[model samples]
Target: MFLGSGSFISTTKAPSKEVAKPAVTAKRLMFLDSSITDSSVEVLQLPSPASLRKCALYAVFDGKVYWLRGIKPNINPVSLFVGNSIVNEDHFLATFKFDVIFIFTSLLFLKHDKFISVPQRIYELYRSGVVDSEECSVLESGMLALWNHNVDKVQDRLEYLCQKIKSDGSKDPLLKPNIDSFRAMLEHKVQSLEKAVQKSNLMMGSYCRASETSCHNHVRKNYIDFREGKLRLFCWSVISQMLNPEARSHLVPAKCDFNDISSHLQSTSSTAPLITSGNKGAKQRKITVAKGTPSILGFFKRT
Candidate 1:
């Protein structure tokens, strides 16, 4: 049942069989403020109201997220926020669309899907009270997370290949055999996830992320296992990190034989403009901008 705005609800770090303490106002649930209503009720706040949707969610477990306490964590663990748009009340949700759900007391970086199956886990924090409108966004968050997670693994492997690259050696470090060797586990997982996606576009879409937070709670239960979106476009790049050579660790040579080459590289990196490609098979274009003032010999300089 939906509590009216300003009515606060109370939650524990984990669902505990407490002796049914007096009910607390839902203020701390929807609104994050320094004002204390029920001293016992733990309040969770985002680093700032702007963290909504863009920042990782947290809960009572890591109460006062982004703030480091002692090894034990001094902040209370009952409140978690994916993002906060307000400090005092639902000025943001009541004003615009109410996007956050304040059911669970603790926050979690999605360990489960929208269903939230971990009875003992904090992902359960995000599992509660997800509405129909949010289904896709939730799915997208999970999809985005998993996609990034997969890409991170590839990028990590690519780190080893960095600086190891000599110009005479293979420029395409991500060759088939190399890609095959590193991406086996990722490929298998993607294929497994794809099979999980084949059942329905409802399964394949970006809308309504199927994050299941609890093993016990059954909300769109089937899709929770596979919170994937439009893999065809993302699989290649994510699985290979082929496009991001700069992310790898660089291996600078201890001795530089070519001073001119080093200077040329510095000039190119400093002067290069961003290049962008147009839609399907269009020529790439360079976006140039003047950095420092032109040298006095500018009149003869080639364009």
Candidate 2:
């Protein structure tokens, strides 16, 4: 077969056993760019192959080599390439941005089609009390931050979600398996999303930590006491909602009451704004000051 400087072997490292078959040449195979054509197109050469059976299908794009390995037996081939130079931080971050956009677009579409009630699923779950308090709070805060386009709050909520999921799984026996399964699913989605974007050096830090913890638990569970009081997760309840006698035990009084100090300050200085208790624990005061007095709120450290 006629060929150019692109006729090369597979980059995959095959076994040492020599297969009694003619070596597959680059011409026999085809590089099909699904986005461009229904049939194969002329593309760059493959890598140097070590053997035939172990030879993997690969493609060179830009300056890097993409190694395509078939995971499942025969049904369909799924590429499991992760880390390395393919999926980097920028790639997954772009993916996260795209996901955020896609979510909003879908919500908009639903809104346009009179499917607005569907978005209230979280609220329904919240009302039913099926969702835990902390989870509901996180979701509510996250959605509010998202609506306000507050990226920092959104990131904080996402980080908290990761921590909560890990903490819940480790502390609760029934939830451990489910959490492990959920984390595994996330890892798959993360890799697939990264691959779709065609970026390398992707970091699996979020889910990897959870997976490592799971593995560590699996090893340690057999050796250590599971019912140790120190290992139990502290009950999560709204600090303001600690009025119930049963739940009051979990509430630990702070070393010094910020409310008391604020009250004292307000009484001492008439110019100082009145500190009013708001919904939840956040406190905000509007104080009249000489034009641009550098925010009175900055004068007092938020406790």
Candidate 3:
């Protein structure tokens, strides 16, 4: 029969004289099946909160409960507590207390349709109660930005091909093959980039957002420490599309021998509008002065 949450089990068999007494206090608990053997009550001390923040979950289990730890992901076995008999049933019922159980439950509840069993080895760190909502939001946004960047790159390449087709008309026989090759390369690149972005998104989405410490903990647990260099790599990936030959010749490093082509293009493009506007303004001023000068000369002659 299935036991309700916090329900204790009492076997029909009476306690034997040889049976050991229960421990006065339980330092920790492990949630597993109710199989009480001499090795059932293994006491596992939890790590300090600061150290726990970096991990996923902390659990203390006997041999019976320890075996269940393998079924769940992100579970960290702490100190073991050994006792003669089970003390409290409610102690193990707190599913959120364990990182592996929490993650598995969240994934099962939130993403029930897509939930799949993950390896326990992967969840050995136990990172529950760490990540906050804001960090999750940031991670989601980062994933979206990466995905959008990939989409934009693909669209730009498609637009370039359209423009090329329009300009060439039916002239060059090699144009179609070149366009096809370019399209295939772009599709391949987009697929690879999308896969990377999706993996990050899944991790971010799986993160629980309850408190700042929790969020920070989750970030610390699931992700590598935030490095400026990693963010720079992301930025570079977004702008990498502009480097394609079809999008802009000058931006394409492969097409040009010089490394400073993009810088030159930026300098020239930025100055062109200013120079044109200045020339036009000067010509207008010259015309206005010329028109007034004739009147001034006539007045001088009359005087």
Candidate 4:
């Protein structure tokens, strides 16, 4: 009886204690894991009902999360999301990185989806004029279209107030001030639009000159490479020479051992794979052999 009891006690007690370890509760955090097939991108719904009406989703990418708003055209105002309704005048959503806040009522416009970087870049380029007139026009047109829609709403409110004053035949003390405020706002918007157009022109000039310089440099380098054949040096030397007069001598090739030269070329060739390592500071080097005859060596830095 004792031997039989001992065997049962050992099996039951150990198994029961092992199984009794607490189970971990997994929190509903958004995950952007590429390892799992379906975990590359995920949209998380917010908790608030008013905010839910807009159907905003938080997109998870790598470790960062971005908010994506759904926009319905001809039904929603683009300004509602990009402008003061959702984001503030400064376009900041909230104090924290992921905190999203809504600032209006009546779902006045449809939510719109856009890459956060795109509009911001366009705004900067427009303000800077680093793009062409055609490209700048398109950006300005889109911005104005959105701005007009928002301004139209404001104008409509002003007109309604004017009608209210006419119908009542009574001067409300605050009505005149409100009308003046709206008029000032309209003028401010017009000035902003003008500034955007002016900035675009400046940006275009800079962009064109930069593009021409790049093309000229590229052609010059190619000519040199074609002339040198297997003895062509790295393009970084040319760029460095352009940037600093002192670095000009560094561009010249010193007599290096044949094995060292071969090793350096191999190392440069291997550097291409490091570009996609998600490192901002990584450098990538490329050797383009024109007609597979080993002609040009280019080293590009990725920041």
Candidate 5:
């Protein structure tokens, strides 16, 4: 069922630059019977090309040639001339002509993702029932946020959109499935944040305990070395007065009657052997020497 389709050669040239710009174009035709058909043809121009860039559209139906001539301007709109054959072929040929405006132009520079105005344009188109274009924007936005790990913003936007869709109540069935997928992605991000918090807490607790144990062990080792003569001190007398109460009382408290801390130390250390007094006429006495290091008593004084 061939109604009409045609091709035309467009030629352009600059007077100063002398650059030749040429492109081919196609036009679609619809018949009155509500059926669609395609009948494409390529038209070769003469050897002498024009100096100005031009695009043409030609359609042939029932042995008639329709000429629709158009020109290009810099960045604004351009005027065009349409022959009478196209106008007489179909009653709604004005609408058909509007649809073919982009067919004659260069579409190579058009990009869906890079265009800054594309989001707004797609939103407008979506309101006019062009939903597929809107879907592209949603997919692109979601992928970018996911790649950058912008969890909060993405989750908020997705939830808001999903709730809005739900409130609309089954108007567009195509969007229902997308809401479910968005919810799943939101849940995944929330769970990941929770796990991250738990891991951080566990690591902090382990570090604190390890640091405390290391400090205790360092202090204990230093005291043991000082008591065992393994480490020479800068001032052994000051340290001995701090640790040994008997030594402290002799040096710092001459009149105070202090308890003998060495006897307490001997009573605590099980490694020391006991010695009994040889005199039977006096009271029996037991004296012991500590085999290991004494406890830390630098802050205390014997009563």
Candidate 6:
């Protein structure tokens, strides 16, 4: 989310500013997502606290506010004021420890969301009466995976939104990190996520059944039905495509959603001793193999 103009937000309308008359109030608008484009850059006529709440991450460029909404329900804000190159995820953590950044000495703001994230959804699940407290505890990781994804990758996504708002003088590529650094950072984070994915599964079975994935009734009620299952968890090749759109090779997951518990199951079985079809003929048969499943499945069973 890039706040294109660098002017302070005013409650009253500024004739010089472009004010958007959103049909819905800013409070209703959730998700400052990866889908940012020049068109989606909006300046609300009257943005309330709730509209500002839509952004999980924010950047101030030139003087206007820009932002990106993340899937996580609770997020502490990290403000990127002018005169910063990049805040590496590692640096974001260390700042809190050492207080090396001068801005930390002063007040910046952040908050928690009561709606529109995994924790909030599970809260509704218990309220829905479809699942018990115990069941909600083992809720699918796909949504959780969305929240737990690498913070740096989310930060890098900020660069594109910033591009949409830059003036001619601000068009320097160095305003963000070089593309190679972006590529390397994305690649490293991706491998780390995949290794974690290979080891994580907390759903009841080997794969999620869409019926059992989320509290469907709760989801439909919240969505304007546009974005319920549409969020990408963390298949990095998708980010890779975003970074280098012209690249010929595609690295997308075939059936994987980066969540081991995705409803689409991976094919892991082989023909079991090829059954006889006719005389001197044999045919292949498919069988489920539960052996390669993550050991954490046992913990769910014990529950």
Candidate order by TM-score, decreasing, is 6, 1, 2, 4, 3, 5
Q: Give the TM-scores of the predictions, in the order they appear.
A: 0.19, 0.18, 0.16, 0.16, 0.15, 0.24
* Prediction-by-prediction clash tally: 34, 11, 26, 8, 3, 8
**Candidate-wise lDDT, in order:** 0.27, 0.27, 0.28, 0.28, 0.28, 0.28
Screening candidate 4 with a backbone cut-off below 3 angstroms (N, C-alpha, C), the clashing residue pairs are 70-111, 71-111, 76-110, 77-109, 77-110, 129-203, 129-204, 130-203
The digit string of per-residue lDDT tens for model 6 on 1-303 reads 222221223223345765673323232223232333332333322111122111112322222333322221123334334346633231121000111010100101111111122233323533466544422332322223222442333323434422222334432222222334334545565666455444563222232222212335565121111111222233342233222111212223335533243333234422322221222343433446454333332211110
Candidate with best TM-score: 6
lDDT of 3 by residue, 1-303 (tens): 112222221212344654543331333344444443233333222222212212212223331112111111123212223366534432332221221221222222222222122221113223233455333333333223322343234324433433223323432111121334443553455456455555565221111111112234345222222223223233233333223222223222243222243343344332222111122343211113322222211211110
Q: lDDT tens string, model 2, 210-272?
A: 111122534522111121111111111112121222112222233323224434333443321
* Structure candidate 6, residue pairs in collision: 1-66, 1-67, 2-66, 3-65, 3-66, 6-63, 6-64, 32-69
lDDT (0-100) at residue 109 of candidate 6? 13
lDDT of model 4, residue 85: 48
Worst 10 residues of 6 by lDDT: 93-102
Please give, for residues 166-239, the per-residue lDDT of candidate 1 as tens digits: 33343322211132333353456446546544565433222123332334444323233333332432332222
| Alpha-carbon runs more than 4 Å astray in model 1 | 1-55, 58-181, 200-231, 234-303
Model 3, which residues run further than 4 Å from truth? Answer: 1-173, 176-188, 200-303
Residue lDDT tens for model 4, 206-243: 01111111235345221110112122322222222221
- Cα lDDT over the full model 2: 0.27
lDDT of model 3 at residue 259? 28
Against the correct fold, how does model 2 do in TM-score?
0.18
Cand. 5 Cα-lDDT: 0.28
